[model samples]
Target: MKKNIESIFKAHLEPKEVYKGGKNIPPSDKKIYKLSSNENPLGASPKAVAAMKAALEHIDIYPDQTDMRLREALVKDFDGKLSAEQFLCGNSGSEIIDIILRAFINEGDEVIYSNPCFLPYSVFSRWYGAKTIDIPLLSPNYDLDVEGILNAITEHTKIIFLTSPNNPTGTYIPKSLLDDFLERVPKNILIVFDEVYRHFADAEDYVTALPYVLAGHNVLGLNSFSKTYGLAGQRIGYAYTTPTIANYIRLIQKPFLLPLTSIEAAIGALNDSEFIEKTVQTVLDGRKYLAQAFDNIGIKYWPSQANFFIIDPPLPEMEFTDRMMEEGIMVRPVSQFGAPGKVRITIGNQEANEACVKALLKIKS
Candidate 1:
């Protein structure tokens, strides 16, 4: 009798939905403005590009398994608030989430997060056979419902994922609410704060989870080089937590998680303060310009502290997306994010922003 491979790996073979991201635009003759993914308007830092070129000469040599050089750069970048030992670098913020899940989650355990969050949290949890609890965000503003999250907690709850300046919605949890929530959360449960868009946030009350991690709480602050550093192509990110948690993650992660070019690029990007400043300022300025344009055009959009904002278009969500594509502009329709009838638009450079606005104006007319 032939053995059934599907039956043999039944647990792993279970049909689960894969996560989807922004739509990609194929090569074309027309000028395409890809404002779909929330990427930096400015390209990669020149210093980082130079470093990546230099690293190519030594591509034959293996990278340091411990990622000591990159960690040291992070230490200086954060002004010693976190030590080298407290950081764990990974391929990207998404991979760091997977690593944490692998390190702690067990079959049938529970994970809690807001509905319409970064889709990977639920996708990854289900892959590990963890039951994901989706707590609904308060409507109108899309702020996290802390009380709802607290009420959903059970003994089986292992991890709680929180995204500040959250994707699609572009809303952040205020410090006051987070502090209160932290005090009430059980010490046994781990809190993962996804702050990949931190650099773009300028809210006075907005703060990263570093303070909680520094206070010895079971918290991890996840950051990425993708947005602010404009190193999305390099696929590198990091997480900072207590030494105990960092050490635990280090145990399960494979050696040389990143290539030399990526590490060197991140380090070089860190050293380029001028480029970083320009990127942030440009995003902020473009955000304001877009907001004013939307208001003038009589379109409703949520205020955003991150690099992107969600807009309720005059047409259907997918219809709006298709229309934008026809105009050589790619925007994301976030119905899968539990945000039906809404479209997410990245704040691009001046020219790109103008092009997007012009396309929207044409659609409206």
Candidate 2:
């Protein structure tokens, strides 16, 4: 009668450690600057806040199962190059990734991604019983290893996950490199571009994956309102691809995947062009400020096109993180992302940026 619960769930007896983001320290009297998660320090759009408040009045009603309004809004945002049918909304970009895996991955299949990239690609692939392949990035610059990725492809390769302005490292694949890679990749293998940090990228040579989708290639571009629109808590994101692929993902997704408030808020956020501009500008400014400060202090950090950048601290990464926390600053130690002895810091508002620099100076002394 003690029975065997493990027998029923044998495949997941020893689950991998779940992916985590930055830490959230509890409230205290001292001012604590949280630059852990790459959130919009300027805060959410006023329009989005208003929309969410308005939606609360009808909290009992279920959201539209079709998600037509949001998809149409996205179409308009893209200037009609992408049809509404080509877009699929999800609770977040990460959830859309899971859905993509569910739609295409078979047991014993293979998925490939760059090492030190986003953690979810590996974690989710394993969850679906797909073999995960890690292609190490080019050293010194941490750029994606296109050739290595191409060499690793086998008949069993089902998907390729690429992150631009890659998490924990902040490096991006050049447009020319991506074009070359796309041409060589088999048409049957689905390619997913996780462009969650796309809005913050100002690299002159950077290219989005939308053009590939428009060209009828087997590619999907995933985006989020969380980082740019400050809608992380709302849990809304989307993917754009060919209508056929979008339909396949939609088939696997449960109805009412997102809440009513999140849909309305995303629509409102989409319309708030001024707010998005302000948020991007703030991050750009903070990036410059922090880079210069780090240089003055002789702290080594990467040149980033994203909202956060990785730094090589003089001390061990965990020790540096602990010291930062002691100074009422919370940053991410990115060993989990495959870059041990390195730390990732989000570009915050002017006040938070200055406080972070101050903490660095204190820690250095």
Candidate 3:
């Protein structure tokens, strides 16, 4: 029985420490510029705030079980014939990923992703007893190695996770490149394009991968309101896929995991066009400022089309992240994302942009 307990619990444990932000420390009472996570430095939209406050009245009731209103709103907003059946509302982008893994992935199936992609792609793959196969992204730009990923597929391949303006790297796979790759990958494999950062991408040819879905391709486009919507605290995100896959995702998900306030907040967030436009402008402006500063400091970083930038400071990545924390600024070290010598910084407000640059300059790196 003791052996059986160990067996069940041990099968899905992460082999490495996943450094989620806000853990491993106490909450700082004074507001420190938090650029570690790619959150909108501007707080959530007023529209979302009002909705959440209104939802406070309904706390006694068990909230909407299926979040039908939110799903219906999404159907109309996408402008396509996106049925409510094609939508799966999860607690966060993370939960949506978890559901996808559970809904798919037979034992020993292969999950392919780029090295330096989002850590959860590997984490949750292991959680479901699926083998993880990581391929390295192209050098300097960190674009997806489309040819390499296409070649890596095997009969056992069950999933491929791609992040546009990828986390940590903040680089996107070109639409044409991805369109070609989608046409090549086997239909049996479910490919997920995690476009959580989609809102920040200013690239003209950026593909949402929705066309593939509309054409009945086996694809799942993952998105979350956490970034551009400034609703990270609300834990609201959604997945759009084929009706079959979406229904299967709904079946394994726990009942009412997404609360009333989160659902209401997400729905309200979608309507605030001005806030989103301003958020995009702020991040783009900050990106320009930070990129210029990074060049001046002789620190290596990439100019991004997304809301964050990746930098290789002159010192060890871990030491750089730690030193900045002491100076009341925190940046994420990309070592966890398989980029050992780099750091990923969110494009914060102007003040944070200045402070981060100053902190970087003060350090030896």
Q: Write the per-residue lDDT of candidate 3 for residues 89-115, one digit (tens) a residue.
A: 888889889889988887789999998
Per-candidate TM equals 0.98, 0.97, 0.93
**Could you give candidate 1's per-residue lDDT for residues 213-319 as a string of tens digits?**
98999999999999999998899999899999999889998988799999999999999999999999999999999999999998999999999889999999989
Question: What digit string (tens of lDDT, one per residue) describes model 2 on residues 1-365?
Answer: 67786767748325686798666767789999899989888989999999999999999988888789999999998999999999999988888888999999988999999878779999988888899999978889998888899999999999999889889898888899999999999999999998889988998889998999989999999999999999988989899999999988888878777899999999999999999999999999999999999999999999998999899987898898889989989999888888989999999999999999999998888
Better of 1 and 2 by lDDT: 1
Q: What CA root-mean-square deviation does each model show from the true structure? A: 1.1, 1.3, 2.2
Residue 206 deviation, candidate 1, in Å? 0.4
Q: Deviation in angstroms for 118 in model 2? A: 1.3
* Runs off by more than 4 Å, candidate 3: 1-4, 7-19, 22-31
How far is 32's C-alpha from truth in model 3 (Å)? 2.3
Better of 1 and 3 by TM-score: 1
In order, what lDDT does every prediction score? 0.92, 0.90, 0.85
Better model by lDDT, 2 or 3?
2
